[model samples]
Target: MKKSIIYSLIIFLFVLLAGCEKDEPMGYKGRPGVYFNGNEFSYSFAENPWKDIDTVLLPILLTGDLEDYDRKVKAIVVSDSTTATGDMYELLEGTIKAGEETGYVPVVVNSVEELEKSVVRVRVQIVENEYFKELDLVYPACNFTFTAQIIKPYNWSQLEYFFGPYSTGWWKFIMEKLGRTSLPYWDMWSPIPNPDESKYNMSYYEMSNIQQMIRLELADYNKHSTTGPMKHDDGEYAGKEIVVPAPW
Candidate 1:
């Protein structure tokens, strides 16, 4: 009889442990959280002729499991620190779509003559809500700047191989020759392809004539010389001859 009781107790304890294990399911049990991709970004409209509206897409990251339904991720514009008037920019609420861990906050800028005259600043903060719990991140509240200045492109480092060296004068010349304001690029390591870059990126094969044209233009400038053969007037290549490598 004592052995029977001991066996029954052992069964009861096993069932209780099994129930406890079932209570703690397999997937994430943490609270949903989100944060900005980075702290700052800057852009210029110096060569952009977007006289109506343009968008600057900023990325956001999520923690915890993705939901089956779309979730709202809000960015509040900090007007006190922003220099762009309400009329100059609109902050679009970001979204982490169903089953997605990433999203974008679309900051819309109204291209007016004002943006071409001076630098415009906009700041934003990511706020937590019921959908997303308060994360320790000092997220979003990111810095954005728009200006008339023709700052060097961010991808200039990788493009250094193609364009030789950087100089503002040469940069402008290259852009004019390329007949485009922005040179979009794709990272070899990106997990998914960026649609814009896939569609618009200039192929190396297409650059043969363009490179020849640049040399021709520089030669023409020297041929009609007021100043000697064109040397880069600014940047690291300043005082050095302006040259874009002939296509291979």
Candidate 2:
């Protein structure tokens, strides 16, 4: 009878151990939630409204405890008919630090021209991760949508219709002279000019060309400013025989 009781006790212990192991959390187990701080983010160039933007950093937050080791979270910019791969914007996949809840993903604007054509929409989401998961019951899932607008500095029709043939040098001359005071506007166009030159992706020439275009357009506006007795108008006043106060 004692032997029978001992055998039963051993069987019970084995079942209990098996149950515990089955219920135990795995090495990567845990509800790690990911989300963006805001639903939408927008930006425009201040200096030259037509100029392309450099980069936009989207803030991401993770909730719950992270794994003991750092893990890479997969992020993807959903492409649609309007926003396709290698189009106006590019996808940004970033990592979440170990034991940290804050991270940032960079959504790079590919073309200033495309932004000017229309409002570009970039849809990004925190996709499935072996280490993390989307928060349940969240509206729209763990996704963020951003709209970027590129405002044209000058009316294209007016620039071409009113102004005669203009060269790039003429454009550069005005930008250097006028763009200096419009620093606040220009600062928005790029975080830093030519941020990475080692990648052989220097944009000095492209940026210079864009700046010149804006300057030329502005100069045309100044040249065509209509003067009336009602109010005094500001002119380019840069080597003009009739100098007037600029209406900044």
Candidate 3:
């Protein structure tokens, strides 16, 4: 009876070990430490860029209607983060289609660190559809602004830091550089010493510098999204336009 009991315990232990190993993949990284909107994101880029690494750094935004589906809209946003400067992120925005009122948005970021060099990139895209017929009205021309804010862990604190050093005369120096403004304050992100001081007072040079950086980053999107001229409706319903029934 003692021998039988020992053999049974050993079998149970072996079965438990095997069951645990079988459920897990070969090389799981476990849970990530940090999370965005409650979803954990791995900083490592296990999958390499399928094309030239530079191609991934460019900002891109694309929007177009589906050929056959009048009620569907498609949008694509892409950005590359493997550049020399340690900044990576992108955002795409445009009008949504009218029909089912369904849409999707995607955000992507890539991080790379080799020796002393580091790079981070972010990209975001939103797709949406709306049913105009349900409202018993024609599709009105509307503009929706979609914005994606890409924040690199390192540079994320720069804006605050620039404003943090208020005593060293750096603020005045920055104001001179940026052409300091007392009204509309300055950049929305710029910190203010007090709220009662409704106007923003800071270096215009610094504000301009930040603005320039933003513009340069976004310029890439316009260049990459188009491959060639697309077929657009001239006036009447051509192959591109599908007129929906008035009463449906």
Candidate 4:
């Protein structure tokens, strides 16, 4: 009876070991596959670009295994009639090497003309190639889309209450540099003085105050054709004549 009991215990241990081995996770055993790091990408004419053109980089990741040999990955732009084209944007194609976990596809916005007409959309997809396969099950899958919109230079109706007719060219300049419809006065101004004389020589608070005064003076000039209470009363320029400073 004792011999039989010991033999049964040994058989049970062997079965448990075999079950654990069977359940083990498979890690990096196959060829590398590609997927976008995220499901969607977006850009806005107001928020993204500082100038006429801008570039956005989308990341593609490798899965399954890191290999000793280089893997070539291909991506293409997917678009329809509703999508923006021509002067609006340019699509890019590229590759990833073996053992590289990430690669980038650069989407360049050539102009904002399409945005003026309507919101523009750009779509891209990863297709199966000789070296890499598209992963459809992933979050970004083999397909992703980007949307761009114009949100700056508030219209007359939007600014009339606070700024009246004075909120024209300068307002657009501020929006372009700050990338927002509303100004955050407190954040732009700092109580601490800047030590770097070569840069601006004034505290952030002082600089912001100067800008505010400039706006108020311009507003008063528009209303009364005369300067307001600001000590540094620079001459006012017509809304159409005002030009954006080269460097903000």
Candidate 5:
């Protein structure tokens, strides 16, 4: 009889707790949101001079409960970052259409003649609205660097340490000396185990030798140069002398 009574009390407590839980209100309130998904970007007209403008589509994330209606992701170029507006670039509205989750913000960058001498930059950011909210993120901003100079050559990364900064005139000079349409390049897998690429591939030592040749040529050219030190004819390094460092 005592055990039965104890079991009845336990059942009653469970029922009472269930009733309380049913009557209580929620303590936390929440809403659906969207987030910034932009990344660092840099472009150069050196690769494609004929193209006057380029559009970079930055991605954004939609969050919370999925709805069956179109939504807009608002973008802002927060003034804290080097914000470029007007002719430099144009930011378009991002959209997540009905029944769809992915969206993008389009930025149209206009080419400027001045870009041949310097780079223009703009930092884009997003804001929260009735449809979406910002996610907590460190380094929430993505930086962009736009220029007309040639992007660093893929093969010249290691050699660049000795070669100072890249210069359009300097690179052209190397090609002229080598009498090749394209300079040799190599990665871990190439020209070693693979013998087919031997004609086009170059070793670090070979690349170093090429650097020495350019240095010696530049030194000789400068010694006899009556027009003064040979400076770059065009590009971001224009008016700057082409200085190739000695072999390490």
Candidate 6:
């Protein structure tokens, strides 16, 4: 009877240990929880957002296709009396998503007269790949961070402070008008894959050409708009701050 009882206890202990192991299950994978500003937010990561089997070198393939794919990275913003911190999105899992690269910077406006505090956070889960053995493979989590600031309408001096001195063309004009009478809208942007660079021969000249074109377009528009009366009259303008939506 004593031997039988001991055997039963040993079996029960094994079962209990097995159940605990299953609960946490090592490795990254499955539905991930995300939070923003102390609020529960919705999000999704790569379908195969894991590199457990091998280091991914090809175009980072999301779990779902591009169009059918919907992923939300959580972000936040905070402000105090003297300064305001822009948004900071966190990259806590894997490499940044393919085609979309985001950078987060603290916005400085006019000698720090007007500033705010902000932060953005994100989370992702990765699963083991069955194709390779653990000895020869490495898994990496992919994630990203983003930041933004509210450019106030009354601070004209902040215009130069935000973009820097080299931006003297249309950027300056836009910033000035935006600061005086309009809410300045900032689009956290990044260059996408250029077809020529991807398929054909890539050259620095080609990249420079594209950037110049964008600058010229913006400069021309600013010149035209400011040329009109009632537009630059007050060295100020009335406009709304339009924040660009993040492409997840």
Best by TM-score: 1
The per-residue C-alpha lDDT of model 4 at residue 59 equals 64
Pairs clashing within candidate 1: 124-141, 125-141
Clashing pairs in 2: 46-185, 47-185, 47-186
Q: Candidate 2 vs. truth: CA RMSD?
A: 16.4
Number of backbone collisions per candidate, in order?
A: 2, 3, 24, 0, 0, 26
TM-scores of all predicted structures: 0.67, 0.43, 0.21, 0.49, 0.48, 0.21
lDDT of 6 by residue, 1-248 (tens): 99999999999999999998888644423422222111122111111122112121111222312222234332223222112233222222223233333211111112121212342333222333331112112212223221223222211222223332222133335434333222222222312222112222424344344334534544555567654422222223333221211212
102-210: candidate 5 lDDT, tens digit per residue: 5666677788777777776778776766676544543345566676766544335444645656766776676677775345455444322211244336676777777
lDDT of 6 at 43: 17
C-alpha local distance difference test of each model:
0.73, 0.49, 0.30, 0.52, 0.64, 0.29
- In angstroms, the error of model 2 at 49 is 6.1
- lDDT per residue for candidate 3 within 66-91, as digits (tens), equals 22243322234333422223233332
39 in model 3: Cα distance from truth in Å?
12
| Model 2 TM-score, all chains together | 0.43
Residue 180 lDDT (model 4): 53
True lDDT of residue 226, candidate 4 = 52
Residue pairs in collision within model 5: none
Cα lDDT tens digits for candidate 1, 1-248: 99999999999999999999998865445777787776776666755665467777766788888789999887788878889888888899888889988877788888777876788788878887778875676564688777766877645554565678888888887788777876665444444323234333765545455567777877887799887777887886789987767555
Better of 2 and 3 by lDDT: 2
Better of 1 and 2 by TM-score: 1
- Candidate 5 or 6, higher TM-score? 5
- For candidate 3, the TM-score is 0.21
Show model 1 residue runs off by greater than 4 Å. Answer: 1-29, 154-161, 164-167, 188-248
Model 4 over residues 121-183: C-alpha lDDT tens digits?
Answer: 666777888777546647433333333443322122323223333433555544544445443
Candidate 4: where are CA atoms >4 Å away? Answer: 1-12, 15-28, 68-70, 140-248
- How far does residue 61 in candidate 1 sit from its true spot (Å)? 1.8
